[model samples]
Target chain A: MKAATPTGANIALFLAGLLFGLGLAVSGMINPAKVIGFLDLAGAWDPTLILVMGGGLALTLPAFHFILKRPAPLYGQKFHLPTLTQIDGKLIAGASLFGVGWGIAGFCPGPALAALVTLNSSVLLFVAAMLAGMALHRLLLE
Target chain B: MENFTPITGLIGGLLIGCAAVLTLWASGRIAGISGILSGLLFPHKTDTGWRALFIGGILIGAACFAWFNGGVTIEIQTSPGLTVIAGLLVGFGTRLGSGCTSGHGICGIGRLSRRSFTATATFMFVAIVTVYLTRHVLGGNL
Candidate 1:
């Protein structure tokens, strides 16, 4: 099979992103209040997020197994999978911090971006701060 | 359970899985929103167009959803101050840990990566505890 051209690859990526965002919107993950409700296990817990995750995992597990069997992607030269295997202080600390933030605002990266169409002031603020935080990490750590 | 939405949640998750699969098939890239967003922020030469288009697609997808559905409901429960702080933590932490819900929680675990499992468990546990502390202990909605 001929390798896909750059344009074709970019088109596929765009479509992928579109579908991902649509999923978030449809699943109500774009709503911070719903996300917090899921997190609040002690409160009137909402298990919708669990089912969402379960559904995602159910499909991806088998799909990834089959896809990785191929030597290369249909469009790209190779799969750019993560190679890190260590469980260290940085990973734990970073995840812990992220969890705190998520619990506080109920806005993870994907949902926040998808929700940007809302043009809500809070969403805008959160996203701007998030970008600043990423820049800060690059400056301080990397 | 008042806010539970099992059907939409499952359907939306399957769509997200399909998005990840498409990205892997076409670009050999993880559909990690944080990583994708960061790449746009600190762009590398010869690797910027697709990222931009992908993000654009997310916004467009969301807009399309609202247009079709008459408007998606998004509630931001956190105040502006807390939203900014949470955004900072999420941005920094996802970068430090190297993935968010879509990346680490879904794709990474689906690939059976041990590191992803550890990160997911750590973040999930911490997020739960944080919610418990904030909602139950603090006795006020954050």
Candidate 2:
């Protein structure tokens, strides 16, 4: 009657994103100025973001353990796990670039889009840059 | 929306994480965000049903939140054209990196995948450094 956990997975992912977005909105993390302020430790640093992240982690950890104990999942057919190791230039380079982009914009793609709903100028810019970044990566890869 | 009392992040994370696990268990998929998005980007002939539905679900979810919560507070601090460009760039970057934060950090790392772990770590490092450079070095706190 049902396909796979796409229903659940998709729903979950969407909901998760919603929550993530909501967090940004509520915590004011979506604001580049606030984010920059947090980063600006030497100046007026606002560490509220740490609390938001911590709260998310707290909720996720227990759920993660509970789900893992199950032999299988209801929506998904198999446990989607990964198996790989080793760090290289791609890893370092990607991270650095991502950080730089994030720093400049104070908005990652996820949060940036969420912030877009707010109709802020900085968020808009960051989102534009992010999409461009994604396109460029695709060309180079494929 | 601003009036809504935010749920404890722990609760939100729980709901989201369980949904992710269930999807993996049911679909035999890794909950790789990039993969799902990439699918949308490069659609295959036979993948219309679930894939389309999935994409629909994402949009629906966002809309639902905005509607039910009285629409989110959109803060467009930047230009519309630029934001779109950023999104494109992110799309490219995810493709290049083979995964997004969700895939690498949550799904991949959860399963002890070396690649995911490395990727997640790299991404985090980059994000941190970017914050420093933008807020401290360049002072582009728009």
TM-score per candidate, chains pooled: 0.96, 0.69
Candidate 1 shows a clash count of 0
Give a tens-digit lDDT track for model 2, residues A20-136.
444445555545555545555555656654454445445444555666777766655655554335666665566455544444445554445555554555655565556556656
lDDT of 1 by residue, A50-69 (tens): 98788889888998998999
Per-residue lDDT tens digits for candidate 2, residues B67-107, read 66686544334345534543554555555566665566556
Off by over 4 Å in 2: A1-38, A65-72, A116-129, B1-19, B25-32, B46-65, B68-89, B112-117
In the order shown, the candidates' DockQ scores are 0.71, 0.29
State the displacement of the C-alpha of residue A80, model 2, in Å, after optimal TM-score superposition. 3.7
For model 1, the superposed segments whose C-alpha errors exceed 4 Å read: A1-5
What is the lDDT for B95 in model 2? 56
| Tens-digit per-residue lDDT, B47-121, candidate 1 | 788888888888888888888999989987778888899999999999999989999988999899888899899
* Fnat for each predicted structure, in order: 0.81, 0.28
